[model samples]
Target: MKNLLLIFFIITLIACNQSVNKISLDIRVDGMSCSHSCAPFIKRKLIKTEGVLEAEVSYEKKLAEIVFNSSAISKEEIVKKIESIADGIYKASIIKASTKETNLKKPSSLNNRESLDFNLTKPGISHSSGFQLPNLFSLLNSILK
Candidate 1:
């Protein structure tokens, strides 16, 4: 009975990890003269993608916001999808990608607000602020020396 329960628990964990999770992405799309050529087309293409759940393109802002299922596709595939269409008229680069929990109560008007959710899972040397600043006092001491 204990062995059966353990097997069930392991299966549940694997299923959760393999679930079709949704992720939101912010992309800076270049190479389009939004006024004359490509914003609407790009938005349409993204919406038509197999795993894309939602897409919002802003011509004036040069931003392509997308929500997609990660299990069905990857971020690299999304970038490639844009570059492969329309003689390569649109080029997209990711600015941010996140899997933040969706807020059911938040108003639609506040959906696209900026956030600073940084993931620290990779192997690297990290500082408190993630960057170093010059010490003004050290500079003054050097001048005196």
Candidate 2:
């Protein structure tokens, strides 16, 4: 009975470690032209990848958000997998990466899909290349005068 109890404890520890090693990655994928074909194709490929828990690909946003176990695969390997798809036609760049500890005590529900919050750029920040719309309009008005 004592040996059985020890084995149960070991198994529980391993299960907890597996859930703690999960990482979420957001990648920006370029070269996808349409939502119908490119998006679904990438999604399917990502789902087939080993260690990937969830993959959401959006052609309109040109982004691929993936969750996987770090123990099974590295972030670089995931990026390489995306780039290698379609004979290397796609280019993938990491936008954001985060580590999340999944709660294993409660059963995960299929209807409960957690959303990732990403701030791709700083708030109230804008960059311009020495060209302003108001300046262009003023120049046009002056020329007309």
Which candidate number has the best lDDT?
2
Q: Which stretches of candidate 1 lie over 4 Å from their true place?
A: 1-18, 101-145
Q: Over the stretch 10-47, how does candidate 1's per-residue lDDT look in tens digits?
A: 65554455445789888898887856458767867776
Question: Where in model 2 is the C-alpha error above 4 Å?
Answer: 1-20, 101-145
Clashing residue pairs in candidate 2 are none
Residue 17 of model 1 has an lDDT of 52
Give per-candidate clash totals: 0, 0
The residue-level lDDT of candidate 2 at 139 comes to 37
Q: Among all windows of ten consecutive residues in candidate 1, which has the lowest summed lDDT?
A: 107-116
Error of 2 at 136 (Å): 66
lDDT string for model 2 (1-86, tens) is 99998965765554444332569888999999888899778877876676676777879889988877686679999999999999
| TM-score top scorer | 2
Clashes of 2: 0
**For candidate 2, which ten residues in a row score worst on lDDT?**
108-117
